[model samples]
Target: MVEHQRRPGWAEVEDFLSATLVQGGTEMAAVIESIDAAGMPRIEVAPTAGKLLMLLVRIQGARRVLEIGTLAGFSTIWLARGMPDGGHVTTCEYLPEHAAVARRNLDVAGVGSMVDIRVGAALDTLPTLLGGEPYDFVFIDADKSNNVNYLKWALKLTRPGSVIVMDNVIWEGTILDPDADPDAGAIRAALEFMGASPLLDATAIQTAGSKGWDGFAIAVVRQGSATLGE
Candidate 1:
């Protein structure tokens, strides 16, 4: 296990900044506690990242959103909370138990009504999600092996001004090493895909906090590139 020494530098700064800027309500706190009680994997975005998602949604005036992962609904609640009234969030979860816990957690947070939980492998469920109104924002936090494909679906289901966010791409900087793990290779491949794709203007930001070192790839859709429109 990684040692939990008190980080006196950037990570500590992040924790302080998060506490100063992002305030979680009682319901939101319960959501986190419930996730722990249920013994779910602790892979959800950090509080700062969750706040960032909310801020991005509010900045973009996004009325509809798609999330590729729904682990205990932490990020899902954040996204839903950031939207205006009548806004909706669609989240995909492959594991039934995780989805069930997420559903309960979302309800406890009072954002369940704003979310549509799609239970299935995202690669399969994504294709069935066609013909709906395109999302104004898409967050890809699912399996990294299919990161490129997720971007393709995000593009297909978004229009100009839409934003795409991919999580955990940096993997503590392992992606830079040629002999890294498969997920690291996949992250590099996704970066290459973003570089070559004409439909998106993409960039990434490194992040650190309680979740350790990682980063997200963010993209904005190009005009007239979406094959389908809302």
Candidate 2:
């Protein structure tokens, strides 16, 4: 993993943007506190990024969302809030303890009913989601080592025009050198898959903030992409 260096200016600008634009409010604050209280990792997306997820879901007109990670349900809350009434989200968490924490946070956020927290390795859980409705949006943010696996599953679970968002792509610029670390290598492989796949039109953006230098990649499944169980 790259050593995340937090320059003062990056954090300051992030705070300013989050306040002036994100405006996540007290509810969002409570969710953040819950993560701390549960001693969970504070690796949830920034407020601005959360808002971006919301906007992306809304823009996609997505009624079904598949999330490969549920870190205290922080990003899950954003995804849930973006959907129209009766929309649902299925999120996978690898740890039962984490899932419990996330359940509470989602309930407190008033979006619990819309979220299904499945506790298991995402690769194991993703296959179970098959034979269901095609997800309109997919978010992959769990273990970096399985990013390419998650991306493949996203393709199977979604239809053409569906959007997929993968977080922590930049990894403090380790992506440029695939040999930098295990995560760097895996992330680079995933990016290569995205770029070379005929099924996706994708791009990655680098960002710096309180989380330090990192980024996310967004892709839209192209028309006629092969979907499993089609």
Candidate 3:
């Protein structure tokens, strides 16, 4: 059953908006279907959220993007579409199966050439990324436990003015409750880290939509960004 089944009315509105406003959303629908058919978890970002990322890309005139999670590449496609003609997106995925599906999906959507998929435990992969000519935009949607670390790396790999967006920050409005979900611990920790950390000027935006009650956190690297208490 589609997640929209839980909130049919709002979901319908989102669907309508996608049909009318989201360019390339038709192909995005097919990408979701393909991901589902491959038996991957149905946890990709909502269509509206995907479009929002693309909007940010356009707003920033971002030429280089880094994505922490590449679930079937749905969001990757959207981010890739938002890039300038020579722009590129580098996304990391832990699961090889999911990476394969994402690759095919990107190809079908005709943006494969613009994306480079790095498959492995992100912890092992993130540290190896270069800091020279830092990325302009980054999206983190991988395991919540490592979000803090990912944010650390994001700060290291990006220069001032770069944008980093983290999904599921609200944990379905349970961010305040320590035991609300398994990820709550990490979510809470990451939020706290961002709050006092000098590296990012961040805020969490709660949202309820076809994907249910959740939200994303967006942070911009300030001048002289650093990790933790550095």
Candidate 4:
């Protein structure tokens, strides 16, 4: 068996390809360009991932979605667009500035009403939000150190068969090393948790293209007897 050699900056390359493929689409392309102009941390999920997310939401017929990060609302727009007519996505951002920009982007995308931009630490906000109701899908793409915490919260609030997509799971090849960096350690822990969790059926895919050196882990909450999209 060949060793699983971790690629470098694969996630970034994937994002670039996503932007490239989605280019020329009037509204989505414009949003991608604006995000590029901002020069913010290039942590947003790739457009292909966004499309996959939308498809997952639509496949589950998700009416309520939760996103842990809302950077520029790029990924949020994709999620919102996938919603069945009245579906809504509640996304959280720790930085006020980022949240504000995301709000604006969502507004520009005409998905403001469907996408709620919450400004605060997702850790603090997730508990409170969970009290109200559960979400049909949850996407995690925030501080890598808190990924495990985010997954814990997501597991509690999502119903059976709900999809939970975690970005940057490979962490620029850091995760493959036995001696882990802080962020890599955290990502490893989350991956381990998902691997062992009885309630989740998870898989990680290695993607290569524009966004470089990374991959994502997608876990589906398993519902016994009852099928998804009931």
Q: Which residue pairs of candidate 3 clash?
A: none
Which model scores highest in lDDT?
2
Q: Best candidate, TM-score-wise?
A: 2
What's the C-alpha lDDT at position 31 in model 3? Answer: 81
* Model 1: per-residue Cα lDDT over 139-210, one tens digit each: 999899999888888888888889999999889898898366989988999999987888889999997777
TM-scores, all models, native as reference: 0.92, 0.94, 0.91, 0.85
Which residue pairs collide, candidate 1? Answer: none
The residue-by-residue lDDT of candidate 2 on 1-230, one tens digit each, is: 99999755988999999999999878789888988998989999999999999999999999999999898988999999999999999999999999998998889889999999989998889999888999999999999999999999999999999999999999989888878699999999999999998899999999999999999999999987776443
Candidate 3 overall lDDT versus native: 0.87
In model 3, the runs with Cα more than 4 Å from the true position are 1-8, 224-230
| Candidate 4, 131-213: lDDT as tens digits | 56679899899998898788888877888878999988886788877365888888998999899888789999876655666
- Whole-model Cα lDDT per candidate? 0.88, 0.93, 0.87, 0.81
The segments of candidate 2 whose C-alpha lies over 4 angstroms from its true place after superposition are 1-8, 228-230
lDDT for 207 (candidate 3): 79
Indicate the residue-level lDDT of 23 in model 4. Answer: 46
Per-prediction count of colliding residue pairs? 0, 0, 0, 18
Q: Which lDDT value does model 1 have at 189?
A: 91
Q: Candidate 3: TM-score?
A: 0.91
Estimate the TM-score for candidate 1: 0.92
